[model samples]
Target: MSYDNNSAATPGYFNANRTATVTVNEHNFNAAEVNAQITAALQGSGVAAPGLGGWSTNGDVHTASVTFSADADYTFDVDYTDLAGNAAADYTQDKFTVDKTDPEVEFFDIEDKSANNGTVAPGVKYSDVNYMESGVDITIKGAKHDKTELSGNRTNIANGESIKMEDFKHDEETDDVYTMTAVIKDKAGNETEKEVMFSVNRFGSNYIFSETTEKFLDDVYANKPKDLVVTEVNVDSLVFNGISYGLDGTKKELKAGSDYTVKQSGGEGSWKEYTYTIKKENFEKEGRYSVTIDSEDKATNKMNNKVKECNIDFVIDKTPPTVVITGIEESSYRADEREMTINLSDNTAVKCVDVIIDGKSVATYAQKEIEKAGGKISYMIEGASEPQKIEAAALDMAGNETTSEMHKVLVTSSVWIQYINNTPLLIGSILGIVLVAGGLIWFFVIRKKKEESK
Candidate 1:
């Protein structure tokens, strides 16, 4: 009889329980006769009893199998008799090693070696820490025993080898949270895995506006002063530095929820959003103002007044422009070139000035004309036989308007009428003197001529 072993070979490591089988092929004997004659036993370093399953035969072939569970070196021995009833040669299998123990692994610490300042403490399940910049090395220290191979997501390591936390680094402008997993495996196919996580603060925090300062200044009807309304901000760090609001060149302190209100959303490795609204109470009246905002994230990325967008310079002018009528009296007939001046004043800037005469706009002076004229509109009242109603209207930059009260005056077209209108008091005095002289001459000369005739 001959035997074949179908199982682990000698000097091989197997962790799982496997059945070792031996097959005997003999044509002279049937399955039942061969089964009765063949016998098997197990011998090993940890085996106390030689336990083996009963032999079974199929046709002329007979097989016997044995299973092992414990970690030990083992060998199998089979004894069988030929069909002729003579004793057959014995079969011996080499040693089979079974290993069921897993290697041991331990992680001591994980640290960041970046330029920024931060702290990492042990926590449950992915706790994030701050000031970890991108492209900086990280160090991981650990211990491993009886390990055949080791590997990592970021770097490969030897079995149970301690890696320098400074060796693993990420260099990218985009911000992200990084996780490194170390896997250890033993010769018996046993594995252990451990992971470390940290956030990379590559992009710094910055302030943005819902409305541009220029656009806010343009849409002045919104009434309040046009200042920074921090929004669309992108903060990638887990730690947050608070926000501060102040007026430029002033000692005024702005209070949150009173002077301004803020709304924030999102978390680490995401686009953080902040909406800052300057409350109406902050601007009690209309005027020009400068607002300054400052803020930072956990990574010490700053957005402050130093940033041009964070420093807001704008004007608030809800009041209308003022128009003053000069060089003219309430009621008078003065017709001369450049006889009246319409002056405009505003808290902000004068956009345009209009001169209305007799309920109709006679002249319009735009920004260029107003600027050239030093914010004044000069006009001559045309000579007319009747009284004329004149008014001056002004518009400011903030879409506010003002119209002056009607100015009623009479003007003469002729030179004599102009002279008469200009010297009204002097002419009145001369007429009074001529009238008295005529009255006296009429009374005295007529009486003397009457007496002479009598």
Candidate 2:
């Protein structure tokens, strides 16, 4: 019942008493034949029982036994064979077993999803795994299904750190609207994706008011009033005076005092009335006055706030005309010629242009007629040979006079000469007379000689 400690065992055997036995009944084989067959099977097969001391066969049975000091697991193998001399089937099993365990993962804290403000500042991180211990590789990917991947594989995310998505390349064939995505990968090759939406706004600069004012001013100046003296007063008022003739024969009625209103012709074939007030103090001192006319088309009722400027210079004349000697030509001429020319002009339109010879107004020249006659006039006098001083004066429309310097001219006789001597004519006449005289003298001489001779 006891066995030595150092012993081997057969395959598929347990050491209950430090021994194992296999019995074959007579139906399978006789005891002696079975014992012989078992011995042969054990010898040929490599199977052994570690629990038995060794393999043995006796009386139609096979036994194996093994002994150990303490309870310890061992390994055993068994083989079986058929009597046809084929190799036996072997079984093998190990005494020790092990349990497969998975590695621990240190998960980081979950980060707030960064607002995809289209900028990379606040970033996001996954809290499910640590990069160092997790058997899976770490990869940050963009959820932008267009295969956009983030640069630098990062697992740790800080607060307010941005997750940058790949630059979007516009596809000509697709719509411009694009969705941004971010993907995070853990060591286990797991990935998470997030997306956000945004749009672009565009703008530039424009001028609203000042440009309009400039355009209005340009239009007003382009159609300026010609005959009227247009002067720009302050922002509110306009003053004008007629350079030629006023609406009435008298002075033109202007918006003289402040808070005065008047009607004017609009640029676009319409009459427009504008309220204007002139500062009398400014007008009296000969300062410029201006008025603003907000004109509206009578038909279309389109109001145009046009600014018209005017200046009026008024002067009162009570003094008689003062004569200033400008220039005078000679007055005394030959008896046949009876007129002398004088040059005269005045500051204002001349009313009368006259020549005075020795303070006698013999001929008066009309200003318009004189101007029509090349801006000068000649005074005709009888017996122009007599020496006299002549002066010319011009009277303006306002009775202002300007005179010319007196010029004294003395009349003298003109000498005359006539030449009658010519070479051919004189020679011919002299020759004819001499020839006639010679003939006559010859005839007389012949008669006298004939008488003497007789």
Candidate 3:
């Protein structure tokens, strides 16, 4: 009879179980002669129970067991005799592995430093430890045996693994503490996982507004100044540097435009005019909100730090002031040197009244001066051509300004000349003509009578 070894007992991989099992398929089978001579051995590892078996068979079916003493590969073979008194000459051989445990992986401890000052976190007295921006260590204790392999994310593990990394800065890029995972695997493909955690702090802390920043925000009255100049904090100098704030701070390694983007205009200088804008929708019911800076997310982003924050409280005003020019008739004539009265009416207190003649500010009454005059200011017009263009701008306390449409005044050279030129000459001139005609008739009649009498 022949033994048919159909499948492998230890299929793909296994730990050091020290035993391999296989089913004995009998042909022309062995029922009574199974124990005739069953032998097994591990190749290069010497004999592992050379002849040990209590044959148990059921018509063309039997069992074979192989024992492994050490971690080694072996071509195990088994031989037996059939019930027909035939000795199987060749050995039924296959591969068997002996490993049953994972390798031991150990990791040492490491600390995260404050990015602001290049100091360790949980500092003495818990001072201003703002951000964490350094590499995390995953120092592995060197392995002892040749069967163990240690590795990190790359997984290029080697014997006696020891790796040090210094690129540990996690902020908006990920939402968890920095961790380095290293796994150690045995020759039989069993693994042991170990991780080291780090606490990376924020790079910069919130600081009280500086004088430059405060004035900039304070001057912002929603709609006060047209094309108002805005000032943006210098990230490189103050915010990210932690120079202005009372916090431990350090320079960032990530480059701007590549690693992160700040919602700003202009450059990295301190207090410069920027093009940052406040949307009209934000002022729907204004309560100290006009503008903001944000580092928006994207489908592909590389920001490794939290978006820097600024806490600013600014009030807004968006309505224009009311402007009216009164006490001046439209398209009317004046000799010269006329006092034109301008009136300002607004919900907010009137700031000023600026009388513009032909688009030039001929006279401007300031806030206190205009308020003292009950929001009415008079401006003198002289040496002005006929239909002189006149406009008035009223400013409210909130910096809202409204300039009225131009009104024309026909300033004449002389009012008396115009009056005489427009009036019909003497109604008494007709009386003069009638009286002269009567006198002439009377004289002619008298002269004619004298001539007739002569």
What C-alpha lDDT do the candidate models reach, one value each?
0.56, 0.36, 0.46
lDDT of 3 by residue, 1-454 (tens): 2222323223533454444454557667654554424333333444444333455566767665545544445555556576676776675565555544455444433532112213322210000011011211233221111222223233223333334343334452222223445554544555556664433323322222345555756664445322222233222322221111111122223333343233443332222112333332323443344332322121222221124344443445567777778756765454656667787777546767877887888777888887788877777777444457889877775677788877877566676543443324444556689999999999999999999999
* Candidate 1 residue runs with Cα over 4 Å from true position: 1-203, 211-215, 220-229, 238-248, 305-311, 331-338, 415-454
* Candidates 2 and 3, the one with greater lDDT: 3
- Our tally of clashes for model 1 stands at 7
Q: After superposing candidate 2 on the true structure, give the runs of residues whose Cα lies further than 4 Å from its correct spot.
A: 1-334, 346-348, 412-454
Ranking by TM-score: 1, 3, 2
C-alpha TM-score for every candidate: 0.45, 0.24, 0.31
TM-score of 1: 0.45
Model 3 sits at a Cα RMSD from the real structure of: 20.4
Candidate 1, residue 304: lDDT: 53
Backbone clashes under 3 angstroms, per model: 7, 48, 15
* Model 2 residue-pair collision total: 48
lDDT of 2 by residue, 355-430 (tens): 7879877567776786786556656544443466767777755445667777776443331100112335567878
lDDT of model 2 at position 57:
56
Model 1 clashing residue pairs (backbone): 135-170, 138-165, 138-166, 139-164, 139-165, 139-166, 140-165
Q: Which candidate achieves the best lDDT against the true structure?
A: 1
Candidate 3 error regions (>4 Å) = 1-12, 15-53, 66-75, 82-85, 109-160, 166-177, 183-189, 200-454
lDDT digits (tens) for residues 1-454 of candidate 1: 2223234322355667756676777767533443322222322123443455676878877677666666655555556667688655655544555556554434444432211223323221111111111212233332211222223333323323333343223333222334445554444554445565444334443444564654784454334554456653443442433444343345466777767777877654445666777765676665556566666666566655445334555566778888999877666564443388888888767888888989899888898888888877788888776567889988877778899978887776465655555567768868999999999999999999999999
